[model samples]
Target: MSTTPHPPRHEPEPGAPRDLVGVGIGPFNLSLAALAHPIPGLDTVFYEQRPRFDWHPGLLIDGTRLQVPFLADLVTLADPTSPWTFLNYLKTRDRLFPFYFAERFHIQRAEYDAYCRWVSENLPRLRFRHRVDAVRWNPGRNLFEVDHTRLGPDGEARATGRTHTRAVVLGIGTEPHVPDPLRPLVDAPDVPALHAADYLTHRDTLLAAGHVTVVGSGQSGAEVLLDLLRHRPPGRERLHWIGRTPAFAPMEYSKLGLEHFTPDYTRYFHALPEPVRDRLLAAQWQLHKGIGADTLAAVHDELYRRTLHGGWPDAHLVPGVRVRTAGRNGGRIELHLEHVQQGTRSRLTTDAVVLATGYRQRPLDRILADLDPHLRRDSRGRPRIDARHRLVLDPAISATGCAVHVQNAETHTHGVGAPDLGLAAWRSASILNTLTGREVYRLPGRTAFTTFGLDQLHPHPHPCPQTPPARHPRELTPLADGT
Candidate 1:
């Protein structure tokens, strides 16, 4: 690994170029960095716009636990022996024994965030507070040129530099999404409407309000509502929770249902017809979007506790309702809502609104505009990602041995596991294996017992032994010499 300090611009040595230039320092890319750290000859660097690592800071409420098990950490799933594992972090903090005695399968969200921070701080190759401005293919040098601006304490641009590398992996992550109907209220400076992403910052003010409404059915919404309910008085607990789904559903936690997040299922989903993939994603929202069973129970218990006082608390839980429009009343917010089932309209006035509407994939078109002509697209204009997670590009770029890889942005192509924490280590290993042209982490041949398709079981009978077996365009294949 190499570090270029304070130079006006970074210039790669005549014979040495970075093996990979990671564009974002989120958990996925951080996993790649940790795995690549011990490799003898692989040179890599990661950049992040923030000065430090923090995952969903505002949503890391007290007692909120991660959906995945602790084993799904940065390096555990792919390489349990790595020093960057969560167990190692606990040992360094002198809490290993306590953790073992706790008998906890799932850790708290704040602890997970802190574990990632420890990894980021110890990793030498990470360049934080540097915003990547542009990425372009340099035909003459046969490499990708990455431009970035170094930021100071106040986030001002202190300097600018460039790095040339053989490959690029984008782990830009996602941003909180606010629905269109309620955008105006959130945009208004005087209004207290905000997204759940900023819940912690405004929690006190929200709790003090006359009425608070949470608008989503996911885990975040449940957590926020539960927190508010616990702090308010019994009879005066004026809270409303609404969502578009018919009922507050528990996530699919059955043993077989989790196979959807395995490597085999990812491969199967990638090979299906594009339209079929689209429809399946729309229908399988509960797989990754529903609230966890434990969280649902907690919410119920909190509400149930409030009812033991002899009178029902001033709380309303409604589903199958959508916010049509929102405006400001004298000192409160007015929301126009529609019932999806009855097609009836109603209005509700609240002091504040929390839009827990979830997040969308951050678009890559802006940063990849220079490479637009070389990118291959699907019918819906989405980038066509191959089984190896590399964006399918035109022959002109592919032939040059440079690939553009994406992380946490392939739900459309890789199924519901795209943004899952459990798949982070495996995905990073796969990308590293492809970049180094060798079996870096030695991934499992089969991760699930369920056969995704019958054709996979019986590729061909004795009818035509000599004929070649059919292969999907997106099927993963080992690259020769990691070129």
Candidate 2:
């Protein structure tokens, strides 16, 4: 036997054009990298500005579990036998037996983060601390140029480089959002107000405050409130939870309800009229934004337990309330609130505030600005994303066999599952299939039992209209469904 080491397959030399270049190293892109590793002829690289892989580090509170099952990992849904599966990570750590005995379907968020970090450490061609600056399509070269900055350990730019690729995938994730009324306070370092994304960082300061107010009724808000409740004294707990929602509703997690995250639903959603899609997205907030039933139950049980002494805890949980404005009052925060139903207004004075207003998709225009002129948009001025997750670009770019794909940025076109973990593997698989121009990962023909539309009663792909109705620049094109 010859004793020789083989070079990595499809490993491009420095400055050589690559098959794919991924902009962000989030879980979605990590999934794509893992699935692509087994392929023989695909040269892929992923970049992330962070020093290492971390998924919601501040919100990974103790006892908080993932909403999805363990099967919704980086590669299991697409290829269970892949060595990068979460189960394989457990096996490598000699914890598979313990995990099996524990019978945990949903793992803790911290554990999931550790698992992803493990994968990031082991995976090849994943460049951390590298920030992608811009992406431009070089028509003459028939390649996309990716400019990136390599940062030092302290996050200062140390070096700059560029790479050329046939295609690019962007997985730039969401950022924490603060309501306009509370943005000024959150931005002030002196004020104790902050978004829940930084909860753990300022947790001790928040607990030390005499009064703490959590704004929002979503899962993060509930989780923060529950954590605060558990730490504070029951009788002296000065807490307030307020939001615009009517009530702290439980998330829609029924068996049939989850089918909306399936690929079948994604295709159905993509084929709908643009106006209908927008309305559906607005109406389906509860599907993804509501609190988990168990989390809500724990909150209520904690509150109820404190009431055993015949006096209610000094915690106020109010809904249907909106914060009209906020300001500082003698080192304390004052929130001007309004009750929507009663048309009543009130003032709340608290020492600290936690804005759990959730996150919004990071805009792609910054990186893709160079190619913006060649990109097509929908009636709402958003990029037109096809069913396969590729941005619909001008023929000048597409004719050259170059494409720009997106992950987690297609909620409007792909439905709420765009940011969902359960759909991560499937979406990665779909993108891979499209990029390779072959059925690399044979996906399921039917993933949901519920037929989304009258025309979709039979399990077959629907034919999307090639051209939309003509309309003026400021008007909407009417559809048959009257959207």
Candidate 3:
């Protein structure tokens, strides 16, 4: 709502490369953009394929709220005094007093989306409708070359251009993840199966169906099922909610349990062996992937209300179930499901299926395909991401000091905090610090009460000196005098 005029679109000057060029303008890169806006001489630009910023548009259901608190906005966690904080947004709309009185910690998802859009509109150097085609290192110029296609309002390519930058940040975000067994049905035009990412768009159709089955038990699944339950009649609500977990469990929201998302935990997780890190990520799903307790309560409350003076609500809430296969049976859909715990199989014929199986990190190989040879990879064929969130590249590229940072795509390397919104600002600040070679926003050295490793307990043991000995290089040789 500020009266500042929109800055003109950026065009890279010939023979001059920018300090950084960000690809994909999702919340992560948007956070980077907001944090970078105040730097005195930092030259940065962010691009997105969409016309404007819209975070999970289809999942922004009414009454649905973010799991994280409002203070975990794009800039507040890293820089509360910044003009672009969420509080300032309310002030711009003249609703600051109302928001202050509301005393709401978790804001609605729609409001969060709107807040991001507001930042997207006001921030300079964001070029929407620009699709980055490829990225490659120009050995001759010692810079990264980015190729992009400019799309018109209709989404057709209108022109193509290239830009040069000393560093790059990839924030393309995630895509709707449909399970392998249900992929065919979701891909077919006639099938009713759709991922929860498009839940709002097809809510009306789902409600009109005779029977609807919601798959997966994450936060999205709970929200969608609750929405459908609220709309359907008490006895006629033929809804089924099933998932792979043992129960529709609540997320770990306890005070100390929440510390896993802190910078301290991220550093600890990063320092562990690669195999251990991989095993830990697979076992820590409940930390960030479970349903919120409030949402679970709402679901329970709705079901209990329906049973006031009648039989049950014709709803089946089952966990430990997985969809083995799915197909179209005339106008209906048939889902072959298995109970992981009971080892039982059943065929469910329903009018619709919503796969809230959650989202996977969109692979970056396509965008960085041209630079594949230069990127270092793990045994699993994944790129090796460093503690600073930059992709580990070959020695030749590293020698140039040109970095390729990733946003929301480092779960395998940084633990559950990688994709979390609560850590978005901190991660962005960290990246900017490395990119600018200066502390633009001062960050805390430690952010948790719990010491993560054994070394913290025996800092100076009986066998070791009270004062720590000076550190030496890993390959340091003994002195010539052998003293």
- Quote the positional error of residue 138 for candidate 2 in Å: 0.3
- Give the top-scoring candidate (lDDT): 2
In the range 3-23, model 2's lDDT, one tens digit per residue, is 121234776677779999999
For candidate 3, lDDT tens digit of each residue in 86-188? 9988988888899889999999999999999998998989999999999999999999999999999999999999999999999989998988898988889
Candidate 1: list runs displaced more than 4 Å.
1-16, 458-483
The pairs that clash in candidate 2 are none
Instruction: Kindly provide the TM-score of model 1 when superposed on the true structure, using C-alpha atoms.
Output: 0.92
TM-score of model 3 vs. true structure:
0.93
Clash counts per candidate, in order, are 1, 0, 0
The lDDT values for all models are 0.89, 0.91, 0.90
Worst 10 residues of 1 by lDDT: 1-10
Residue 76 displacement (Å), model 1: 1.0
Can you rank all candidates by lDDT, best first? 2, 3, 1
